[model samples]
Target: MFESLHQTQVIPDFDEDEVMLEDIEVEELHPTSTETEKNEWKKRKTRVRSDVWQEYTKVMVKEGDLPVERPKAKCNRCSRRIAADPNKHGTSPLWKYYTSCVKKHEANKSQTVLNSDESGSMINWKFNQDRYDCVKMYLTRKMHLRIFSVFPPAMCGTHLNLVVERGLEEIGMLVRRVREAVKWIMASPARSEAFKDTAKLYKVETSKFLCMDVPTRWNSTYLMLESALPYAPVMALFEIVNSAFVRDLKQKTHNKKSIGVPEELDWHEVRRKCGYLKKFHKLTEEVSATSYPTCHTFFKEMCSIFTVIRRMEGHEDEDIKRMSTRMKS
Candidate 1:
């Protein structure tokens, strides 16, 4: 295991006047050099603090009798020196040079990703668990370097789904009954066609064609409910018409548990629960429409979800109130 900061070996460009070197004592080597001469090359204060600084050392040269700092940044991994005038060009040259060095070093070592366009180049360097553990063990625990991690704001679809999942439990019975009813109708091509005929018979326009929910995503559950709710009357009549098929399903290979149809009470519960869920579904659609969504939009949607759930906490129904309160917690 490597202990100290890692450095790479790079070849120097003979054409350039700049070269890589470590600190050297002028007085010890050249007794004629005075203390005042040594003090002349005192290291200048770095105006900007950057991680790139860790890789390169400033070359100190002697002009006759005095040691002077050169306007150059040298790569530790290689002898290549870059022209770095902080006052004039800032650290731009140093950053660009380091980026190239990283690219070459990573490629030579068969490491994946990392190389340009300023900060964009650093995006691909995968900092997985091993690197994370090393930072914690050597840096933080050893107190050698203080590292602060800046995390991006949490507003992904995963976060939204997680937030909605608990609230869904409140109306699990209603969801299950509706899911079962939809599942029965959509079980086979024959049954699906029959359901479409029934929808026409009742003149109920099923938008998603009896789409069901995937267990992982709650938006699908909301969609499943959205499509199924409009066909409440259709489902009731269809269930009665196909009672024998449903009975046979239970006796045969289908789920042995009672695939109960959504009753009036279940439908009522679904309607009430859908009020908050619709907000999530709409926001989900808006967010999904764009490949990249702004954090401001996510912030507004998050606040909207919070408001809906908070309002539900004060709902007249005790079950809704309890569910909302639990979800808020």
Candidate 2:
């Protein structure tokens, strides 16, 4: 029973070197029959190999089989082929193909929805937390006092949205600067004395200068003057003053040429010919040597009054223009 169990448990080991039959026994078999069978077996083997080759070719064609070539460099974002050479690609440590791809994707996505014009540039200011906060607060407070004086708290937000959307950030800054200019002017003893006497008439005549009134030549002058005031910044003020001076010079040159008069003339004659020159000369002398801050402060205050005027007119640009035309007349 044990011997039978051992035989049953034994497993066959198929070795290539092991002989299946002795040579003599194999030679005894029928040679013709064996030859025929061997030939048929060879033919079957060839057919099997052929079939495998055909199947492999079909698979190769279906799967787009190609040689394993070296990987080429490419821009991840644009999928544009790049040079394989490291030097050609750039050697910067921080440079990354994947990062650029992601960035390009994001930019394209944003550009698709956002405006791509000059007006769209204003969005950057909105995203700037610090700048937006300061400007928003300043404008909200100031605008509320002027235009939105009767507006409820709920309406204030709506007004702010309208202003911001209308690109009034610069206007808000202008108003603030003008308010500062007024303060400076009031603080200066010389400026106050020189202009204080003409304050009432100036107000009436310069009413067109107010942002609320119709914009006119005088309004433009006031705008330039307030815009140039030292409190705003020497650079800004200089630009304003320089522009005004150049414009005035051009006008004077034209007038002289038109009248066929000489460039050089006596002061009294000049004053008589151009009555505004006398007043301008007085204001110029008072402001010419003034500190940047003092001039800016005065300009700021002047701008504030304009802001008030603009608000009073319901923020109508047409009204400002009409008022300006009247002032010029």
Candidate 3:
């Protein structure tokens, strides 16, 4: 047992003759300067490209940006050459232009939509949980007032519907043609200016600018017709001045369902329609007053509207009676 313990304590040694010495080469690990620079350049290019692409998408969604859909780097408005990395797809410049365009569009839209917000109730108001009930009460009353003024509870829903929507629907094709004519007139600034010049030549005084009616807003149609009625004689004068142009338009659109220039009868019909919609237009304006609460006047205003329609239903004019009958249905 003592010999076994001594043997365990002894260290095993290799014979010097079996051990051989040789030179072993060690490789140095140094980063390549050129490769590092290339990596940095790649990173910078990727970051710039990503930023540019973000800008491009924003511009694409904005209104009034030309080539808004899948636009290239060239600016549609300014016709300027956008800068981009030559080695890359060079799409960043275009994207940058697009982003700038969208920002401009948003700024314009905000200006138009919120022009009256400065005078609104919330102009200088602060919001807090402590005043939650007060705010709720204010909103509820304001909403109720607006609703009653626009649509009085005493008036039948169908009555409002018949005047606003059903009447327009009854004359579907005629409304469509009028809409098309207005669209054509307002298609370009040149066309609009020409129309105004024609009005001047005919010595016709137009009170308002030509307006395009919004299809969803029937009141807008009435407003459009009202603005257009006085210009009928001027349009006739324009047709005479540019008879060849009108003839060409007629020839080109003879086979196609194109929006044609208004004829004398079309103008007369527009005037007649405007006369028919005078009461509706007045009522719409009265009810849509935002600065003043109109609920108190809803009863009187609605009664007047009903009385006019009732009288029209038995009018001597065949067209007026027919229109009233359609509204009744």
Candidate 4:
């Protein structure tokens, strides 16, 4: 009975609740670790796909050695194949097809000539007072020709002939007719009023008193002067003549109307206007010095000014006629 020394120890049971309640803090500083790993995997997959695609593209290019089929172009009218080269044909599809049509259109175009019913009127005559003065000087002084040479032969003879032919009084009737035309043209709403007025006035006075018709006689006079001078002097003389004519017309009109006021009436007015006059004079002087080039430049400027003025005044028909007349004369 004394041999059995058995020790009875109490077995401690482990509590799950106590273990769960224990503060077991996990230090997870990198919270996106799983997401980062997923992104790296995706990148690797993308790289492999890109490499495969590039290799496929290279293989395709090497095998083909040509581009895909291009769109075909054909002419609508002829139903023919049209070339794509712009230099050989034209840029637009329509342009290449319409080339022959355009040429045909141009070929079919007609020439138009302006017509006027007004009698005793010469076309393209301008009142260049300066030109008139120069022509007068050239005729009377340089060429030793009478003013009669500068003017058309006495319409007196023509009038007498017409009177005889038509049985009409020639003397005062012609003058009266011309004067009426002058007044009518002066009062006209046309841009040609200036030119017509000057021409009519010249016809009236010159024909009535001097038995001359300079307006109709300018071409002959110009030719005679041209024939007499060297080319350079001829051009200079022409400009001078033209300028004098314009100046004369202006002067005569002023004198006739008794508008004797000087352009610079007041001192202040002169000062204000001087700047423009100075500029004009400077340009004129420069042109005058240059001779032929100046003439060409002036003529070009004049045509441009005339064009603008015509457009503004709505006198395209009159302007065209006047320009053509000038060229012909």
Candidate 5:
């Protein structure tokens, strides 16, 4: 048996602690020409835009906007081309320069007025800076800002206004109920305490009291609904506890106005309406931002609004569909 067995060296077994595993180096195989071509196409297909202009260009059409001159990028608002090559200008410098150009254009336009003669020839009537400044200063000193009230238009062919007004109309009953609930709680200290007690009873957290909404200000009404929704359960309980008070109040106002006490369904409606209106609310906030030019985004925003309205048209919820239809009108 020993002679038949092949001669072999005896291997000693090392302890587990003495054995160390070295990291294996991985080698990447060289890609074939076909794969390389495929990879190049994939990179092009999945290319991500890192610059603001690249992202903006997707939503912006070259039509209606000024075209950039060769070797430089032009701003849409001011039509100012970059002094240097846009590729080397980078993000910050390019955007800053463009905004500065817009401001400069705006300043020039403010001081410039057009005058026409009988022959229909036009001349640029420039205002004196000193005179303009003096007039502005005098107006600021003499005019009372409080007396000059600015009432924003409700419907001015804008999508924001369309949605907001329709949503408000749909939830008009719910709004009145919320307004009445707020009045009920605030009219008496006892009712207010009872309202807080009910919230405490239900272990509900409230950060603030219900806010009042101005009749003309729909934004404030949305805010009131937002604040009131959280305390809906508490308000419902308070209404039950003071049912007699509510009934007597209703009877007193029977001829003047109907103070409908909000029930569970009414509160739920308020919550739903708030959720529906939130999109318009957010749109308003975005468009009203003072930091950047919103006019450029008008077309994009209107498209988005129409898209939302179209989606809501087929919504499973009847209220949403109804609101969307009303907005369409």
Candidate 6:
């Protein structure tokens, strides 16, 4: 959304996550004329931006005021109009208005900005550190952090999911093949029974079926791989119990088609990937404690992630190295 504003209008560029502006109060929406832009702008929303408009409103003023017909932001509280030209300086002026001008604004706005929930409740949060620090300083003294205030140094659990998703993309084909294999097994009662029998033959636990991952949730994929890795040795034995699925993959491999079967190398890759992810999965579980502060523990988990990424960067596989490099960048 911010990128679109920068491309079409004279505004600063921001990542998709950066422009999540929060609206302070719900105001009447006077729809403006439609545009002819190539990109569909209506679909996009900027949520985190509400704080900027909490005390101001963007309104057009006459040409006589500034020699040019320029837009001005009218203070919602005081009805004072200020220059709002979409230029290099984006919303900095408007942000400075409140807390500095209105005495009530200072009283209403929190310096520490905990914005936290009831004690012991886990909730999703998002905030950039630079922005949070700047806002904190603007509202109060430097390093005047309130005791018990929790602010994560890294992305929160939900945002961390985006990073995990991208990393998972590095092994998308392998994941898909595993998913297909699971589907082939669980989609039929007979195949599932054969799987249990095969597991029994290999002395592998037949307590659970091969998990099929939910595409939207990364952890499901982790669970899927985690369960399937135990059956890696027995996978070749699946050819004996379930030759049809194996035969199909063999034919595809022979005919220059994409391999949709979990092979030895593929299982090896899954095991390694699962090892890396299992740590993060545990971190998320720990950080998910909402009743108490998890921020302190979060930093330690971040260190672990950094260490893991560095190790992955030095791995023998080029694919793993490529993935870690992307994650680092």
Once model 6 is optimally superposed onto the true structure by TM-score, how far is the C-alpha of residue 220 displaced, in angstroms? 0.6
Model 1: number of backbone collisions: 6
Alpha carbon RMSD to native, model 2: 23.2
Off by over 4 Å in 5: 1-159, 188-190, 252-259
Worst lDDT run of 10 residues, candidate 5, spans 146-155
Q: lDDT tens digits, residues 1-329, model 2?
A: 88876775557886654465555567767466878988888887222222212111111111226654432344443544433323343323123444454445444434556565766653433466888789767767768445334333353223323322233222323333333334344455664554444444324333322222112222233343333232223223333433532243334322134221112222122222123222332333344444453455434433343354344345345533343233222
Q: Rank the candidates by TM-score, best first.
A: 6, 1, 5, 3, 2, 4
Per-residue C-alpha lDDT of model 5 across residues 1-329, encoded as one tens digit per residue: 88658778889986764443321222125556888899888887334345646312322223325764344445656565553333565556566765556344444435855558766678788879999888766655556432212212232335456557876787676787778768767778887787787788877776877778786767888888898888877766776777765775465342366756778888777777777677677778778788987877754655566678788889898887888888776
Please give the lDDT score at residue 160 for candidate 3.
Answer: 64
TM-scores of all models? 0.50, 0.20, 0.46, 0.14, 0.48, 0.51
Clash tally, candidates in order = 6, 32, 2, 20, 0, 12
Off by over 4 Å in 3: 1-162, 170-174, 243-260
lDDT of 6 by residue, 1-329 (tens): 88876785567776765444322222224233454242457667444355687677777777775576777888877787888776645788877776566634554555554546768456787768999788867545543532213233336788667767888888888887787788778888888888887788789764665888899988888999888888887777887666698866645442355766888888988888888889878887888887898877876786677778779889998988887866654
TM-score, model 5 to reference: 0.48
Question: In model 3, which residue pairs have backbone atoms overlapping below 3 Å?
Answer: 56-95, 59-98
Candidate 3 lDDT by residue in tens digits, 39-109: 89888833343544433322222225563333234444454545443456466456556666633344442
Between candidates 2 and 5, which one is better according to TM-score? 5
As for lDDT, the candidate ahead, 1 or 4, is 1
Ranking by lDDT: 6, 1, 5, 3, 2, 4
lDDT of 3: 0.63
Cα error, residue 328 of model 2, in Å, equals 6.2
**Which one wins by TM-score: 2 or 3?**
3
- Global lDDT of each candidate: 0.71, 0.37, 0.63, 0.36, 0.66, 0.74
Tens-digit lDDT string for candidate 1 (4-68): 44666688667432322212353356555566567666754656487787778877533445766
Measured on C-alpha atoms, candidate 6 has an lDDT of 0.74
